[model samples]
Target: MLSPRAIAHKILLHIEQESGYPDRLLQSYLDRYDNLDPRDKGLITELVFGVLRWQGRLDSIISRFSSVKLKKINPVVRIILRTAIYQILFLDKIPARAAVNEAVKLARESQPDYVVRFVNAVLRRVSDNIESLKKVDKTNLTASGIAEIYSHPKWIVDAWVKELGTEETAELCRANNKTPPTSIRVNTLLTTSENLAEELRRAGIEVQPCKYAPDALEVKKGHFNLQRLEAYEKGLFQIQDEASQLVAHILTPRPEERILDACAGFGGKTSIFAQLMENSGEIMAVDLSPWKVATLEENLERLKIGIVGTLQTDVRKLNEMNIKPFDRIFLDAPCSGLGVLRRKPDIKWKRRPGDVYRLSLLQRDLLDSLASLLRVGGVLVYATCTLLNIENSEVIESFLQNHPEFCIEPISDTIPWMKVFARGPYFCSFPHRHGTDGFFAARLKRIK
Candidate 1:
C-alpha cells in the first residue's frame, strides 16, 4: 500500500501533465486509496488544491532556497516541496517534522539519495520560517506582486485593482485561493427539499439549506461520497454551484414554453429547467462537442427528463428543422472562466489577458446567432462563468448597439434575493461578495 503522500505525488504529477479537472481527478485518485481516513483524505485534498492555488508563492519560496528557478526545479521534487510547505504554512494539524519527512519520502521514489536529501533541506528551511511566510508584506504590488504571490495572473489582478480598488483586489485574490464549499442542487422531480433534507439526515450527513435557492443544499459536515449515498444515486440531487443554479430561473421558462439551452454541457441547469416546466415544455439543448452533449443526454435519460431534446451542434449556428423561434433562450457562453477560479484553479494560470477579448468576440457571434432563433418579445438570458467586464457588461453593451431590437429588462422581480446585480439588469456575482462563483448574466427582451 502506497503512503498517502506517494498517492498525492502521483495525483499532483498528473495535474501538472494533463488537462484534467482537479475535483474529478482528485476523487479518482482517492478511490484507489480507499482505506485513507477522512482526516488524511482532507489533508491530501488541501495540499493538492493549495499547491495549485498558490504555485507562485510556493515557487517564490522555493526560489529563495534553491539555485534552480522555480520552474527549472525537478517537477516531482517541486510538487513535493509545494505539498510539504503548504501543510506547514496552512494546515495546523500536520506537524512540520512529519510534513518534511513525508516530502523526503516522496522525493526518494524517483530521485537518487542525494536529491532526496536536497528536498529535506529545502523544506526544513520553509518550516523554520512559516510564520514569516504567513506574514510577508504584500503592500508593494509590483516588487512582491500580491496577485502572483497569491497564484493569480497579474492581468486579472490589474483588472480587479481597477474595478475593486487595491485593498479589495488582494482580499479577493486570497479568498479565491481557499477551497469553495460543496453546493448541491436537489432534484425536485424525485423529492421535495424537505424530504431530501430528511434523507440526508438519515444518511448521517450534516447539511444546510441554501439561503437563496430553494433546491440547493450546502454540506456542513460528515464528508460522505455523494455518489454512494442513496439520495444521490436515486436521482435526488446533483453537485452544482448556487450561481449556476441561478441561470435556469433567470430564464423563467413557463410550462409548455419552447426554449433552447445553448451550450448546455452536462445538463445540470437544463435538468432544472425540465423540472420547472414539469415535463410540459420543449427544450432543445445544443453543444458544439458531441462528447459533452452525450453526457447531458445520458443525464436527461437517467433523471427521466421527457421534455429535453438533445442535439450536437454549435450554438453559433442552429440548423434544426421546423424550429422557428424559442420563447426563452440561454447562451451559457464559454469564456475565460475567470469567475470560477476557486473550483477550476488551473484556469487562472491557463488564461491569458487577450483570451477575454477573443472569447468576447466568439460570445458576440454566438449571441447573434442564437438571438435570431428567439421570437419577438421573447426573453433571452445570456450568461458566463466569467466576471470580467469585457466578457460580461461590455460585450452585452456592444451587442445592444448592433441589435437595437433587444433591450435590457428588469430582473429584480425575477430574482429577488440577488440585490447586488450588474447595472442595467445584468446579474454579476463574485465569490468574495456573493459567496458564490463569480458569474455574470444579463436578461434581454427582443422587441420587434
Candidate 2:
C-alpha cells in the first residue's frame, strides 16, 4: 500500500544508484501492485520521469535554497526533495502545501530531525518563490543558460547549439521534454495500415496514420497495454517510432533477397524488413547480447515471421562467422542515443561529453567491419538514432573516404514520404520538425 510518492522515491533511488531502466522498473512496480488505481499509477510515472527529466533544474533550485551542496545531501533525501520540488514547479494539479507536506513526511520517515527541518525550509522557500523560478528570460539565451533553463546538461545544449543553431536547439530541447506520441507500425504482413487503424479505433484506441512512414500509426489515446491488445498479439502492429520505421523502407529489401541485420537489437527493423519482404527473404539477424537475440526470436515468433534467422554474436565479428555476403545489409549501429531522449530522458543525464566521441569510433569500426559483408552493388543502409555529426555524417564521410567502392544512394524511390525526411541522399528526421525521434540513415551501394 505504498503511496505514489513512496513508489516514485524507491524507483528514483534505484535509478540513481543501480542499473535498471526506469521504464522497466516502473512497469514491474505497477504490475506488482495490480490493485493500484490508474491515478496512482499515472502519478508515480509522472513523478519518476518528471524528476529525472528536470533533475538539473531541480538540483539548481534545491542548491539555491539549501546551504548543503547537492552531492553532500543523502541520496534518499535528495530524491525526496527532487520529487517534491518537481511537483511544485511543474505539476499544476498538485497544491504547493501537499508537495511540501509529503516531502517532509517522507523525510521524517527516513532522515533525522535536522534533515527534515532542512527539507521543509528549502521546499517552503521554493513554494513561496515558485512563480519567479518559472520565468526564464529567453531574450538572452546562452548555452549554459539554455542548459539551466531547459534542465539538459550544458555539454548537450552547447553541442546542439553548435550544430543546430540556438533557436532550433532550444526547440529541440523543448521537444525532448515533451511526452512523445506512442507510434506503432502496422505489421503489413498480417494486416494493412488501413485495416489496423480501423481495428484500433474499434477497440477504443484513438489512432491516426503517420505522415512519414506509410505503415506507422500515431496512437493518441488508449489505456490498455499495446502488447495485450488483440491486434498486437495477432501481429497486426509493433510499437516503433515513425522515423525508425523508415529505415527498413530506405533499405528497400526485395522479396526472396538475402539480407543481414548486422546489429539487430530486439529486431525492430528486422521485424519490419521481414514484413516488407513479405516474410519471403532470408534475414540473418545478429546481436551481441544473447538476451536481445532471445527477445528478437520471441518477436519474430509473435509476428509470425519466418524469413529472419537469429544469431547471438558480436556484429564486429561477422566476418569470423563465415556468413555469406547479402543483397541488402542493415547496420543500425549503436550511438549515444541522443535522438530518442524524449522517450528515454535518463540518457540526457547518463551520457558524458566524451561518450559521443567514443561511440563515434565504435560506429566507425562497425561500419568498416560490416561493409565488407555486403555484396557488390548491394544496398547497405547505415542508420543511427542520433543526430550528432560526429556519429552520423562524419562517420559516413570517413568510411566513404577509406572505401571508395561504396557510394551514397538516393532513397526517394524507396517510399512515398521520402521527401519529408530526405537530406539529399541521406534520411534524417528531427524530433521538433518530424514529430518523431531524431534519426539519421544513409543508403550506400557497393559499386565494385
Candidate 3:
C-alpha cells in the first residue's frame, strides 16, 4: 500500500547506503509489490532512476537554497527533496503543487513536525523559482560547470573533458541523462529479424530494425515484459544493446570453431556466439562468479543453445587451467562502465577516478592470461562497455606492446555495416552518435 514516492525513497536509501544497483533493487520492489498498478510501478521506477541520474545537479540546487551541507543532511530527507526537485524542474506534466504536497506528506510520515516544515519551506521555494532554477549557463564550459549542468560527478566530467574534449564530453553527458531506447537482439536460430519484428508488431509493439547490427530491434513503444511474451518463451529474442551485438559479429565465429568467452557474465555474447556458429561451435563460457555461471547455464537451457560449456573461474587465472586452445577468444574485460550510463546512472555517482586505473590493470592481466589460449592465426576480440581511453585503446596498446604475436585486425571487412562504427582498426559506438551505449572493441589476430 506504499505510495510510489515512499517506495522510491526506500529503494534510494538502500542504493545510497549499500551501493546496490538501482535497476535490480527497483525490480525487486516491483516483484515484491505485485499489487502495484502499472502506473504506480512506472512512477516508482521513474522517481528512483530520475533522482539518481540527476543527483549531482539536484544537490547543487539544494546547496544554493539550504544552509546545510549535503553530506550532513539525513539521507532519507535528502532523497525526498531530490525527488520533489526533479519533478519540479524536469517533469512538465507534474504540477509543482502536487510534487511539493507529496514530499510534505512523505516527510510527515517519516520525520518530526520541524522536519516537515523544513521540507515544505524548501520545496515551496524550489517550485516558486523552478523556471530560473532550471536555467544553467551553457556557455560556461569549465569542468565544474559541466559537472553541474550535466548532473554527472565532477571526476567523471573532468576525465571526459580531458579525453573527449569539452563539447563532446558535454554531448556524452547529455546523452547519458536522456532515457535510452530499448534494444534487443533477435535469436536468429529460432526466428528471422523480419519475422520477429512482424510478430512483435502483431503483439502491439512498435519496433524497428537496427542499422548497425542485423539482428537488433529497437522497441520504440509498448510494454516490454519479455518473460510474459510468447516469443520470449519460445526463445526468439534476448534483450541486448545494438553495440553489444556488434561485438560478437566482430568475432565472426565459424561453424564448429573452438571459442573462449573469457569474461562471460550470464552469457549475453556467449549465446550470440552460439547463434553465429549455427549452434555447431563449442564455446567455453567462463566467469568469476558461480552465480553468474549458474545464470549462464540457465540462459543456455532457456535459449535451447547446447554448444556453450560453462566454467566458474576467474579469467585472470585461466592460464593455469588445463583448458584447450581456442580458435577465437573474447575478453569482455570489466571497466568503469561509463559507456552505459544511460541505463545505469548510479555508476556515475558510485565510481571513482581511481577505479578506471585499477580496472585497466585487471584488463591487462585478463588479456595477457587469455591471449595464450588463442591458437596462432586465431582471433581475439577485446571489448568493454566503456568510452575511457585508459580502459579501451590504452589497454589494447599495452597488450600489443607486450605480445608481439597479436596484431590489431580492422573490423571493416568483418561486417557490411562497418562503416557506421569502425574507428580505424577499432570499433567504437557512442550514445550521442549511434544512439547505442558507448562501447569500444578491437579485433586482434594472433600472427605467430
Report lDDT (CA) for all predictions.
0.82, 0.89, 0.88
lDDT of 1 by residue, 11-78 (tens): 88888888688888899878878788887787678777888888777777889887667877788888
Local accuracy of candidate 3 as per-residue lDDT tens digits, 174-271:
89998888888899888998999999888888899887787899989876365567887788989888888888788989999999998899899999
lDDT of 2: 0.89
Q: What ranking of all candidate models by lDDT puts the best one first?
A: 2, 3, 1
Best by lDDT: 2
What's the lDDT for residue 322 in model 2?
A: 75
TM-score of each: 0.95, 0.97, 0.97
Q: TM-score of model 2 relative to the true fold?
A: 0.97
Off-target runs (Cα >4 Å) in candidate 3 are 413-416
Angstrom error at residue 101, model 1: 1.3
lDDT of model 3 at position 244:
89
Q: What is the lDDT of candidate 1?
A: 0.82
